[model samples]
Target chain A: MNQEIRDGLRAAVPVIISAAPFGVLFGALAVDNGLSVFEAVTMSATVFAGASQMVGIELFGQSIAPWLIVFSVFAVNFRHVLYSAAIGRRMVSFTPLQKGLSFFLLTDPQFAIAEARYEAGHRLTFRWYATSGLALYVFWIAETWLGALFGRLLPDSHALGLDFLLTIYFLGLVMSFRKRALWLPVVLASSVASIIAFNVVGSPWHVSLGALAGILVAAAAPLEGVREDEANEGRADA
Target chain B: MSDGTTLLVILGAALATFATRAGGHLVLSRFRSIHPRVEAGLNAVPAAVLTTIVAPAAFNGGVAELGALAVAALASLRFGMTTLFAAGAVTLIGLRALGL
Candidate 1:
């Protein structure tokens, strides 16, 4: 394998390792929320968005409207639209089949790594991207199954603080971007908006509104010339 | 909901979510020459949206606990602790010990 591919896979392994426990926590929560083991694993396999799956399971437990549950999942995952755009540009020269396969594996961490690689003038072949995706895919399925089976043996996750994993994941992402001061206000504003929306509107809608508000605010804010230059360089690589 | 019905619904929702993600790529692939500005904006969207979702949950779980977590987050950042799990673990343990 070329050095670029080797480096990409190496960079991705640590991320996949970190993601394993989060997957297990999701599996435990899925069953605890009253999903059957089969249903839980199926969701992990097919849906693949951890936070959305958790939200869907919670809404299911509450016996919410099916359409509302679907909408909520979409809202939570709407960021994938952005992921698609970014990844799509990188794979723009690939055949439709290759593009389609890569798109299926897109997720937050994968996108972050892929975008960074592309920006650094690294060549991301289909095989490299697929390898990262496949690793994560296997880890997610296996961890979910384990969590569902062992959930009964484990203590209450919320009490044990496993519930905090999702927050930790987000904070890590934010900390990684600490050099970009613009993100600070954008994140803070979106969070405050969501909390207010939660009080006024409620569960699913709050998430959607808060996210939309954040994206709009961030997109509107002017980036420093250096940030813009970096973004342009990343874009040029695609 | 009955077991059979719930199973059907969960499966259906899972398929729908997958389609939404897959479908975006399927459709967008046909287009050529997407605007550079749009592409740049989209690149930043995932991190921004994720931050919005995570920040409130970290700080707003409960007021006192939120304060404890803030302290932990600051400490973690100050010490250049790169692992999020470490920061979160410390905050949770500290809060419990403080009787919050």
Candidate 2:
């Protein structure tokens, strides 16, 4: 096995664990919403975005217009726009085809882990990205199939703490980035803003709104890194 | 909805979702040089976006959820990723079992 592939698998374990329940839940709900097991599995394999897929099924259950459901799913996943833009900066070595394939698997955790690796000064190679992404993709689809087939037999999710695992997982990811510049203020701003948005605006919207608030804070803060680089350049020129 | 319609809708969403995923990079790449402020903002992306997912859950949670997160945060300071995750999951399940 390639070293980066091994590392990618290592990075993927926590994600697979935290995401397992939701994948199963999504499949069960998709079936309950009138989707065939095939369709449920298809959606998992194709759309591949959990929150939006959930939104799609919920709307499907309501017998909403198909276009409306598609639009809603798009709206729910709009945050990926920001994620793609942010992570794209580090993909200098990726071929055009690799970039295309990479974007297809660019889920929230994938982006977070890739960006963290880059920040730690590691190269963002295609091998590692594809390895991690494919591992997640396979688990998600398999879990969806299992849930569609046997979701009802599963134990109580709430009692098992399945509902809150991602929250715990994400909090750990956020904590891992504490060494980054402006991390605390960014976390504070996004947290408070998301809480407000989650209450008032609703699901999905809160993510984008909350992230924007924090990014604006970072953009407007004193340019600690850039300023020092410029000062050093000025001294060198003199 | 018919099976055909369901498939169509799912495919439509897949396209739409892909657009958003690829759209940002396409738009950003057009710029020859990114401004420093923009770079700073991009650097904050992981923390900023991830915090939103975590915060609302923490806020809406009751005793069990809150306790788990608290345990998890503390565990993060001393443990590896898997250990902290286990600590958090154990705390959540334990607290919920205790009727918190």
Q: Which TM-score does chain B of candidate 1 obtain?
A: 0.68
Candidate 1's displacement at residue A86, Å, is 3.2
**Candidate 1: which pairs clash?**
none
lDDT per residue (tens digit) for residues A74-154 in model 1: 776766765675577678567778776677678777776676567557677787787777778888999999989997676
> Candidate 2 docking category?
medium
Residue-level lDDT for B84 in candidate 2: 94
Over 4 Å off in model 2, which ranges? A227-238
The best candidate by TM-score is: 2
Provide per-model DockQ scores.
0.38, 0.66
DockQ of 2: 0.66
- Predicted model with the maximum DockQ: 2
Q: Could you tell me every candidate's TM-score relative to the true structure?
A: 0.75, 0.96
lDDT of 1 at A149: 91
